[model samples]
Target: MTTWLITAEETVIADGAAPHRQIEIIRKVHGNKTREEALVELHKAAKSHVPDSLKGTSRVVGRDSDGSCWILPKNGKGHPPCVIRFVEQIHP
Candidate 1:
């Protein structure tokens, strides 16, 4: 079986490779399925899954030209941004 893993990550700053950067694995969703089904499921989960870092406050969604997804504070309520991605894995 193949398991699709949706991983969401959060950082103290925008730069992933910044020195003294704080990184956190905020959320992950997984499902076992074929490639086509897993891709659909993982995409849906990525678009809809809320990160643990910003659960209670209001938020907005943004998409970069390079296809990065971001979650931000709706009213500048001090919530940090979150970025997510999905990956496919195979298992016996």
Candidate 2:
């Protein structure tokens, strides 16, 4: 199976407020799928892990040439809220 590395930066809301915390995530996804398909799956997986309140305005960011991916809020400006990187191999 091909391995896909996924990463995300999450913004935590404190007391239900704006811009609370930034959480970084890196995960390995295994499957024989195309890059587009893998991206979709990764988005689904990432969405499943975040809180429901943040679902409607979340997005994924990555560069194929650079082999990087990330998740961020839709309304964010400048850098993404979270950044992710995908790798074919996993390190211990």
Candidate number achieving the greatest TM-score relative to the actual structure: 1
Tens-place lDDT per residue, model 1, 46-91, is 5676776678877776665544466777787666677665565445
Whose lDDT is greatest here?
1
- Give the Å shift of residue 60 in candidate 2: 11
Residue-level lDDT of model 2, residues 1-92, one tens digit each, is 67776655555556667775554445667767677777676656555554334456655444445444445556665432554444455545
- List all candidate RMSDs to the true structure: 5.3, 6.0
- What lDDT does the true structure give each of the candidates? 0.59, 0.55
Backbone-clash count (model 2): 3
Colliding pairs, model 2: 7-84, 9-82, 69-84
Give the lDDT of residue 64 in candidate 1. Answer: 58
